[model samples]
Target: MTETITGLHDVADRFDAFLIDQFGVLRDGAGPYPQAPAELKKLRALGKKIIILSNSGKRSVENSVRLAKLGFDEACWDWFLTSGETAWRMMAAETDGGARKRCLLISRDGDTSPLDGLDYNRTEDADTADIVLIAASEGDRYDLGHYQTLLQPAAERGLRCLCTNPDKVMLTADGKAFGAGRIADLYEELGGAVTWIGKPFPDIYDQAKIFLGAIPPRRICAIGDSVEHDIAGARMAGIASILVETGIHAEASPTERAALFALHEAAPDFILPDFRL
Candidate 1:
């Protein structure tokens, strides 16, 4: 029974800390939401702890700079974390015992900063690679179909795919763009094993607990646009969630939204029209 709500103001008093998503809640790709920064400031003023949790494949610093450029200063939030940062640290520690030392990297616009300072060898040929790591998509021009040729061969080789970003799509001012998760899904369909390291996986939420202190699950709320990612992640992590309607599912009607929640089995405690606090 998810209740549709006007905004976070209706429930802000019920939680002491907030785990917020960046893509659709805070800003689209173009810039910051008109009221997002100020609303965050209000929450902070009310003594609420806020952490920006993103499924972005970019590192923490890169995302910080991007947010700053979008008119959100570091003062607006207490801390920020990204799936890329978590995955980069995991790879740096060589946590995956099954993955080989060499990896075939799939990325966007030549951004390979996640692999920087890591000992893993990079290869262009998937045949010679030990594993496949997808950090980003090629953007709007490409879709899941465009990567079939690349993933099919790797799948046949039985390569393990590590997807840093679990978001299937990202909504920005320009439009929706396919993400690494879409390609990872295709690989799985082709029988390739995939390790999703971001939202809905629980590892990222555990990492976030470090910043959230010892706040109980009931006291924390996750606000995001994706049902499969954000809402499902929160449910699995033992925290409440508020599904924002204006982001990924902006075009979905009430019936479609209900159907999505049912399909995912991840109904949020509340449904917000937008991220207006």
Candidate 2:
């Protein structure tokens, strides 16, 4: 059975490093959680190495800037890593002899920073593109049916999709909303191939291990809100995990929570009501 705790203080001395998730664990889309910054500072004071491990589709620098704007001090964490940054680095290091592929990008608010330094050409027409990139979610502005129609052409063309954010749901200003991973799921259902690049996958964890330096897996703890991504991924990476209740499943009933754990076949080592000291 998983142990429940009030805050990080309960297990502070158990781990030397923490891999914290961004969206649901630290803040919602609108702003930072009230006690988050202070709690992080407290952890830092205790000599705990912190890394903001996120499945966000934006690059690491962009996320850092957003966190700063949200009032999180830069001194709270040692380094930041995002699935988008990891994917970008992988693409940059690829030695394929083929020419640059034409990319049809789908993102929230039309942001294209994921492709900023890449060699791929952006395309508006799906029929003419060689690949599809699902970087962010626009669920607030459009429905799933809209995405199904928009991606049908690309699916018919068998364009490969690279999904940097593998979170199926996200905490938005209006509560829960579909994330980019949902769009990627729709593409797969439409017969298109997809390559997931974020949490619950090995690539991002491999990169995170490098950033975490010499910390052994036993001394590392991953804290996040999603059981599918955070808890499951931590298990896959051979580290301890803590699930906070103040994020994506904040309102889930006890029964619903149990079903979710059963569905994912993952249980966190600890559970907390929020991220606090």
Candidate 3:
């Protein structure tokens, strides 16, 4: 039988390794949470193999550099995996023709996150893009009208649309739901097919697990902010999960937390408010 996770230490004791979420629990979009890096170090000292399982839509070099700045270096986890890397590779492979190296990207405005070989053009330069890539942008300035103007026509002309992060919205520390997953949701609504490159999809998770040197599923803990991706993916892989209460759908009150549990009707083996313990 399964159970609800109550404390960080309780869950940590049960697993030999952890696959944690980045944007919400460990750090916000702005900076690192003080408790997160410390918790990661503690886990490392105890001999756990830690991997930052992120839906970050950027290259591995960019991801590694950012994590190092956030203090996730040799002292913390042993590995880091990004949705950006997976998505880019998949997109690069899937399209054999149609302007081999060009794509139109809709990510956070200041984002230079993709891999080295992946080529891109701005929406303003949509006339030249061969593929339309939609992720989360920085501000609300890039709305439906923006996507329609740049991406819709490309879709109609049979160009591929790639969604980097599958999550629609994320919870802020102050408690707000904001994310890029919504754009993917909408594009799908408009009958545009997209290839999700993040978790809840076995391809990425299996690849991450292999990075752990062939660890068994039962020995791993898939921790994250969202139930749809983390929990559902863990279910498919037969691994346990820990829900961090700091990301999208963060718990403002214990009662609200319980209600969320009820809504998903799926319980995390452990619930961490932050990375403490």
Candidate 4:
């Protein structure tokens, strides 16, 4: 509701574009925020080039369906890209140009549709995979054992651990949900390393902004909750960041807030007291 612009607006205004985060900024996983739809709609009327860069691995089509179901109209922005889609592309690119490779994935039940051609394998087949990829898959049966016995091998052998979503958890309409960040954490705890190919990372931001087709990164306004990822990522990318204090660490203690602010050395330009938009 306030027009407080950042001093770096000159350099950050290049794209006139926006690459918004999903969970904390726009809505809490439960349903669309009361003011998010309107905020986006107003931005659209202002002719902002926008892209929904979600960490969900199923790609933008899935986001298209989910966003609408969550009350976000496609007309509000120009593009929508997901970490799932980005993860798939990264895997496909790393695979042998000719030889087919197997993949051991922990995906949701109905979410395996995007991973069509790649060979599917179980956790036991960890050694066979050219890459170890993790997404926000079905977690009903997912336990620490699977990682300890199966996926650990893939990571131990130095196979690339790719995380589609780098978020540890999110409170959706149903309840709190675990994403690839948790899985990645498990692997890391087991002495495995990974490369998150999407947001909070620069590569995804560059790709999505470029995909906005002529839009510059400075023109984009980044919004989200995770100071470690969203806010820090925006600072590194030199874009304006808006912090929504309505999810994740919303009830942060004073020490927590200090650590969050100190994590980046730079503070957010805008802070939404609640996830209203």
Candidate 5:
């Protein structure tokens, strides 16, 4: 029963701030959407506060750089928040309390920025690691089976996995690819415990609320493409939501989209064909 709309301007006056998703809503990994920058500028001109709520495994600074590189105006958004930044802050704040944990990181292209200033020791062997950090997926290079084999040792040892990105699929230059969340799911299937640290989770929303100052939850809206993450997260956070059909669910048929909504047990207040002005 979601109302269909053309773009953000349709509901511009209904909200004071927006928690916008980055990956599928703003860009497709390779470039930004054609109307995205203009849409952002329009929202900014309307005196709306904008925050990029991304489930990326990279830090906020990295995301901001990427956005700028993609031709987005830096003045469009007031703040940028990513699950990786949230996880990094949490990890950095942890006091080893005399027992430093050994971490085995699984990130795209071996990026270790998540652990750059952390106290956890990095390990190359899963058998020697105390916890598994599923920050990003190398889906473009390896298959899910590759991860299953790589993580079996850690799973056998009952190591906990901290998944910074909870996206099940990532948009690639070619098409959809496996995401870090899928890898975390595999670890759970292999009997390893996983701690999700991204969208659809309360921690990230709580942090977004802090950044939003005293904006009432009822006056804020979240826009994203994933039913499981964006829409569901908004429901859990007690805010309005808008579903964009330009990201993970871009190609979903009517029946498939219905199934997804039912499966997630959540629906957006409004739906848009894409993120536009």
Candidate 6:
């Protein structure tokens, strides 16, 4: 049975640290959630260690800048980790040792900063590329079908895809839109090998453990709005989770929520309307 609560304050005393998701939990596409920064400050004031563990494939410093511009102060959390930064580090450490690695990148507005500082060469032609990297998308304006022509050929060549954002859909202020995970799914269906990074994957959790040090998993709580990503990811990492009802699942009925947890075979320890600390 899952316990439904109003906010993080209800169970704040139970955990020594918090691993929070950034998208729906902290902000939408347009801007930060009105109460998010202050609520995080409250948690910080209580001396709880906080880490912003976002599935976003954007670099950590870029995320920090974005958050700062959105009115969030850096004092709210101890550290920040993003799947994009993780991907960049892994790719940069690749031992291929070639002049430059070629990759086909799927990104938003042609932003290629995630691949910056790496030895990878970006290519518009997928057939000649060594791998595929999905960082972002214009989901609100484009559908999955729009990417089929590009992915189909790569899939047939058995190209391996590295998806930074593993969220199928993201909740924005305007509405829901497809994410990089959706592109990864399409590539898989087309016969390409895919490495979905970020939430719901064990690799990110392993990386997070490096930052959390001696704190046992039970003493840490992961708060997010997506059950498929946040809740399931926390479960995989052996940590407690709190699913906020404000993101993609905002409109889900009680029965629907039950079905989702049952479907994923992973339920959050608690549920909240939002992260109002």
| Full ranking by lDDT | 5, 2, 6, 1, 3, 4
- Among all candidates shown, the one with the greatest lDDT: 5
For residues 108-195, what per-residue lDDT tens digits would candidate 5 score against the true structure?
Answer: 8878888887778788789899889999998988998999989999999988889999999999888889999999999999999999
TM-score of 2: 0.97
TM-score of each: 0.93, 0.97, 0.84, 0.83, 0.96, 0.96
Model 3 lDDT, full chain set: 0.69
Q: Which structure is stronger by lDDT: 4 or 5?
A: 5
lDDT on C-alpha atoms for all candidate structures: 0.85, 0.89, 0.69, 0.69, 0.90, 0.87
Estimate candidate 4's alpha-carbon lDDT, on a 0 to 1 scale. Answer: 0.69
| Residue lDDT tens for model 4, 127-165 | 777667777644445665765677777767877777887
Off by over 4 Å in 6: none
C-alpha displacement of 196 in model 4, angstroms?
1.3
- In the range 91-147, model 3's lDDT, one tens digit per residue, is 567655554456667776566456346544344355566666765644345456556
Q: What is the Cα-based TM-score of model 1?
A: 0.93
Model 2 residue 18 CA deviation (Å) reads 0.4
**What tens digits encode model 1's per-residue C-alpha lDDT throughout 1-277?**
7888897889999998899999888887777778888877777788888889999788888888888887776887777888999999888787555544777888877787878877677887777887889888875767667688777888999998889998888774578887889888888999999999989897899988877888888999999999999999999999999998767888999899889888999999999887887
Over 1-277, each residue of candidate 2 has an lDDT whose tens digit, in order, gives 8999988888999999999999888889789999888888888999998889999899999999889889899888887889999888987886376787788998888798988878887887898998898989989889999999889999998988999999999778887889999999999999999999989898988887887889899999999999999999999999999999988888998788888889998889999999987
CA deviation > 4 Å runs, candidate 4: 1-15, 95-97, 117-124, 137-146, 213-216, 253-255, 264-266, 275-277
Clashes of each: 0, 0, 9, 17, 0, 1
Q: In terms of lDDT, which candidate is stronger, 1 or 6?
A: 6
How many pairs of residues collide in model 5?
0
User: What RMSD, rounded to one decimal, does every model reach?
Assistant: 2.3, 1.3, 3.1, 4.1, 1.3, 1.2
lDDT of 6 by residue, 227-269 (tens): 8899999999999999988778888998999899999888999
Worst 10 residues of 4 by lDDT: 1-10
